[model samples]
Target: MKKICIALDYNPNSEKIAAIGHAYARALRAETILVHVISEAAFYAMEYEPFMGYDSPFHLNNLDMVKELEQGAENFLLAASLHLGTDGIKTQVLEGETSDAILSFCRENRVDLLVIGTHSHSVLENVLMGNTAVKIVRHTGIPLLVVPTKMEG
Candidate 1:
């Protein structure tokens, strides 16, 4: 594989995924790219409607908020890189729907393999809220290395 992409989120279990993904990348002698996609809901968590002369409590404007979000995501990828203790790994911070962003990036970058973390979800929960890993699996043709990040009961 020439390039391997690892998708990371804010979930704590992402650390495990990163570790295993990096090890695999090293073994394959492939270039690694760590990607973090910031969903719009994550950036705009508050719902507010302004009435006559009403102002939103959020101090930063939308543009500033987006900048902050991007910076935070960059820091996250950097921390993951540091934790992996590796050099020459590329990092990308994308904006949009999580799974779509990841898949598009992989396709555009011609990533040979995608590494992702999967959370344990009950059948009902899976139906109610579709999982990103599931969505990727259904849509992408790239090879995947899904790390199970289920917490112990």
Candidate 2:
């Protein structure tokens, strides 16, 4: 594989995922692209709930907040790229449906391999969240490596 795209999310297991991707990239002698897809729900929640005390509807109207989120996502990817410890590592932040965005990126970039982290989820959580990993697997032609965060009981 000449190019590997690592799908990242804003979660505690993200650093671990990056480490795994880094190791795989080194072993394969592949270029790495760290990608983070921002969720619109998360953007509003971060701007409105904690900071605005959930009082103002202004967060929904705030374009600046969306821009801020884009910047933050880019910064997060940059930090992850550094953590991967490879000069060939690149970062990208895209907004939209997570799985679709990731799949499109892989297709457009000619990625040979796709890597993502999956968390163990309860039945209800899986039903509600609708596993992005599964969706990506169903949709993408690229080879995928899913690194589980931990074993479930």
Best candidate per TM-score, number? 1
**lDDT scores of the candidates, listed in order:** 0.90, 0.84
Give the per-residue lDDT of model 1 (tens digit) for 39-98: 973546454677588776554375667678889999999999988988899999988888
Q: Lowest-lDDT window of 10 residues in candidate 1?
A: 40-49
List the pairs of residues colliding in candidate 2. Answer: none
lDDT per residue for candidate 2 within 13-61, as digits (tens), equals 9898889987898899999899999876355645545353456764565
Once fitted onto the true fold, the runs of candidate 1 whose alpha carbons sit more than 4 angstroms away are 41-48, 51-60
Error of 2 at 145 (Å): 0.2
Q: What is the lDDT of residue 41 in candidate 1?
A: 35
Deviation from truth (RMSD, Å), model 1: 3.0
Candidate 2, residue 83: lDDT: 72
Clash tally, candidates in order: 0, 0
lDDT of 2: 0.84
Give residue 89's error in model 1 in angstroms.
1.0
